[model samples]
Target: MAEVEAADFETAIAECGFGLFNVFILISSVPCLTAMVFSAATLSYVMPSAECDLKLSLLDRGMLNAATYAGMIFSAIPWGFIADTMGRRVVLICGGWLDGFFVLCAAFSQDFLQLMVFKFIDGLIICGPFAVVVSYLAEFHGKKHRAYVMLFVGLSVSVGAMILPLMAYCLLPVHIFFNVGQLQFHTWQIFIAITSLPSLLSGFLHMFLPESPKFLMSQGNYNKALISLQRIYALNNRKSRDSYPVKKLTDATPDRSDVINNPNPRRSRQERYKLAKKKFCDGLMQLRPMCSSPFLGLSIQVYCLHFCQIMCVNSVRLWLPQIFATMHTFRIRGMNDTSMCAVMDHNTHGRPIDTKSMEEECDIHQDPDMYIDNIVVAAVGLAGFILIFPFLRIAIVANHILKVFLFLSTFLVGGLYFSKTTLTTLILSSIYLTMMGVCATTIISMSVVIFPTLMRTMVLLLIMTFGRLGSVVGNVLLPIFMQISCIAPFLWLCTLMTIAFTISLFLKVDVQQSLN
Candidate 1:
């Protein structure tokens, strides 16, 4: 009798049937994505109230803001390598727990140096799940639903951003202070702790989820991969595993054996050490394919786009709390006829000193309007993501959408620079930031489609590494640029967005021809 050939991965996955399990996967992803946003962004909200506690100067604030990105930039590749070599599930679970732990540690930090160290470590651990989760989620879905699922992940991110300001509104204004021995606990500290719960919860949720069947197949674990698909089928379709239509998965790499399932209980120390060394070297070797041939050009374009988009978006996004606070100060002083630069200038060099007052210099009271403004901005971004979700299904629409958003963002950035009223500045800035954010997610979705499964996580991490590097640079430079001249940072961002838009134009060919 002739042997039966197994179904291909995509075909097998599609047979798993998208229902309860698919929805569970998407629901489970919310906290993981939300944790990434909160870990990176919570510091922006914390800094305003924490300045007095940490005794932060402008340089200190910039460094603190950049610290998490610095950690992510350094660690992204290693996490990617681990995910590619091992499995995505372990990486996500372990990373989430460790990230949450570091965030909790940050909450207890008593000084600037301690908090800085913890925040950096938080970034290092969080990068694991942040870079891997999207790839992990995409592996489960068929090509038809993959792009939409990734965009939904992006929408979850915007939800996380919206949650941030609401949390800040409820927590940052509260007056809480106490001393536990040498440690001083404040409302900001409590806020940090609260923000960390999502990472922990995400880790907990992953414990119940199955490994990515696509990742299993990539490692030549055909039997285990088929079993995984069956499990997915059982959960998603509410049927017995025997009912799964795909009996087996086609062996993509027949030469490679299943490294994950066949574990030896007892091995000599020397043998174990040698095995570890070989796997590490093999992981390093995985980078070669991405750096050469067809992938190299696509990698470069997406990486540059990620860098520029993140640089512009984060440079403004991370400083929004401070900027809003500045506006509050301006309004307090009855300044009506002022641009953003004028308000900045007034806050910097024109404030009248009230030496007669005997009140504490550190005012942690955030006005209600600041939080409302932030919520409004986040809500606008969220709405944009929802509105654009349906159009993503159209052919070539993602590419066109990217170009339009980038061009609009560039124009909005320039307009933001010239706006003389608070409402005008807020509206332009909101649209600009939202558009850039949407473009960023669109780029990630495109990358997921363009790259092969073998090097997908590696490519994403490399792209994200560039993006975080841009963020670190932007966060550090924006402050210095503002001090030099307000327009310098805006002009710099405008130039970068223009360049990104141009680079995006070259990506059409690769995007149109993607295998996914």
Candidate 2:
């Protein structure tokens, strides 16, 4: 192994140059991550419509969602290894291509089974970007600013969350366009394909972007890493200084053969510590030896976090629209069966006087304004992640207790049955929002921090896969309990969160400190 000496660095970044490149990279990657989240979250909206239009059974719908997760669960480990072995750029590019292809397939699917298969495959392939992007961004920046930079990643996904409903509303008309005779391609297919263009553009842009300097150093490409860094500085229009202030690698930069054949270096702690400071810049790309070790404790912690977090988030996200619809029945102003019928007719876009009206009538749904107000409860969940960030140094045991209490309280309170009164619905919906928002942000951020760099891809994909499974569970329960007591779905969500709360008590390591 060779060492990357400090004498090799060149402090060439021009004023305002580095900031622009960083922002450019962030802008490109944010949408890539955002699209990933948006597609997953919006699937619930698409599935039922596809099912009803295609006359698929409830079992078929459940299979579609489950199929998506099943593919994800199976593909993650290998894909992570690929990202580790081949490179993030290749995997990310392929991920974008696969995402575009399968989404188009799903939109064009003629039968329920076809849609199921395509979605499953898409889910598996799309995860490559999600897992790789974090590692990609983490390597470029200093450790001091990692958390704050990652916050942008979180906000990007939040933006995705906000826009997903609008996309859903816009594309819902795809079904209507199906009845037309002139168009060769259906509207849904066009919608899916259009959504994928950003990913395609990202893939091309990534080619021009410099490979992670640390990754090159990890592969014993010290000369290449030097060249790449110089190019980065050039692109940023920074002055081409003779050398950089930072050392490129510590713990010895392994040769290409050595890295490929041996990811884990059996080196002494003294040797590792010696390189720690010098290699700080390049260390971001170095995989912790334990990442591949069979007995690694961090791996287990991340797995549990991913599994539990996804289950809770997906369970709530899939149920939100229904929850709001349930609350709508309680509205008081100018409400009557006739008005409800008229509203349903407007929403459904139909003229069938009696039969169609009988099948699906509205609750004289109030202004969609109420939807935003009631859903504020979920904001508490989102807030919890941000609030807990500064205090994350506390022991996991203490954090575990608060997390459990937060979820259990929300579940129990939100699950309680009450008259369909407008006020009661408003209050309960708020609780539902809080529980879900907090659970999602906390787990997602925690997952990124906990997983070892090498296995990040695997852990994230597994988390998302489980989350999709949760959505399937919710969707499946929807039709069964749709006719039963109105409170059944709420009870199911409460139980799922309670189970997650119990699971959190067993974990110990905080991922945020894994690198530290």
Candidate 3:
């Protein structure tokens, strides 16, 4: 095995310049991650309508919310290995198209079983695109620009969360009813379709993308790595390919051939099976080193911190809209989104709410105002991420800063449900939401800065995977617990977040060294 140094690769990438190339990738990958957000959070758009027609129980709706993540909880780590084996491009292309197809199928599902199946497949397929984007973007830039790239992508995700309901606001109210045999076309269907387009479109667009240079280098394709870097340099600097800088990387760079992608052209089925078994065994052996001795402790620490962080942050992201909507019913002046959807729902049955009332007791009204509020709060959160990025040049400061914000946000939210007036609750909620973006950016930045290059991709994927697991558990229990008491869900959030905060107290990472 030959060496491929990070500094050498980093220098070649840095010569590519952080202009048009990084901007293009940063823009394209946004929709991929945001589509994952839609997949996990689509229940927000669907529940209000499902409450009208599907006649779903509160628990049933919660299951639907968790369905995609149910798939995610099990799929991500395996997908990480696949990404390492088959290459990022294949995963993104296949996963992107499959996710859209599954989501589209889910939109047409006539029963709970069908919807869950399709949504699970959607989650299964999406893990690739979402997880690969982290590594893909990192491979495109030098370390100096990597944090900015992640922050920008995070900002895009925040914007996506903000715009989802606004888009739902515009499209979900349309009374566009038509039929294709057993299928009915309506707002939720339309919203699902619109959200699915980005993934489908991006997937096809990705067909034209090159494999990650770092992945190529890992595969011992130094020529291909050089070509990829040269291409990026030309695009970013608006120069001819021949004129790009950084002709070659150092020959003495580290050899990471253990995880490199290699495919044989002609092999028997039995031979392939044996090869896979051997590779799997070998990969397990490789992982054992990281899980034992000195690296073992840090590995466990990072995963636990990640698990706890995801448990708290994802819970908040997944349920933000519903929590806001539930809070809306307490409003004396605003009409809930239920009333807004009345016009669309009544088109099917002359009286939709009347029919739904016979099935289950409905209490809180869905307010579209909360959509606007989410968008505004999300914008504020985006600002928080941007505000924190510069300070993140100091890695220790980043983690500590996040801890302080987490403490404050928890306090605001824990007191929110106990507020004396609706106004006080609203104020607390706004500040709580504002703090979310800051917390999110910090988590990602710390992970990127602190983890080693060899382990970075796997760690990020685990963070995302466990984050989905958190969402699955949180959404499932949120409505059930909220039914018990107004403060019950927040208390749950506070406990998980406090646990995350406490975990951070003991877990240690070489944040300053990784950055330097």
- After TM-score superposition, the amount by which residue 435's alpha carbon in candidate 2 deviates from its true location, in angstroms, is 5.2
Looking at model 3, report the run of 10 residues with the lowest lDDT sum.
339-348
RMSD of each: 2.5, 8.8, 5.6
**Candidate 3 Cα deviation (angstroms), residue 180:** 1.8
Error of 1 at 48 (Å): 1.8
**How many clashes (backbone N, Cα, C below 3 Å) per candidate?**
0, 17, 7
- Superposed model 3: Cα runs more than 4 Å off: 1-7, 242-245, 251-282, 326-370, 394-396, 420-422, 507-516
**Residue pairs in collision within model 1:** none
Q: lDDT for each of the candidates?
A: 0.82, 0.54, 0.67
User: Which model, 2 or 3, shows the larger TM-score?
Assistant: 3
Local accuracy of candidate 1 as per-residue lDDT tens digits, 155-254: 9999999999999998888789999998889999999999898899889999988888878777777777788888898998888988887765675467
TM-score ranking from best to worst?
1, 3, 2
TM-score of each: 0.95, 0.71, 0.85
Q: Which one is best on lDDT?
A: 1
Candidate 2, RMSD to the unseen true structure:
8.8
TM-score of 3: 0.85
lDDT tens digits, residues 1-516, model 3?
A: 122243467777767778777777777787797887788777766566555556676677778878888898788878877776557888888888888888888878776777788888888888778878877877777777776676776777777776677786666545566889987665676777777987897697778778888777755667777788878878888888777656566534354443343556688999989988987775455345455666567656556655666666665555555545544543533534333123222222332246555333232233345465556556666676667667766666754766777677667757755565435544666677667666665566666656544455566677777667777877677766656655566678788778766766775554333221
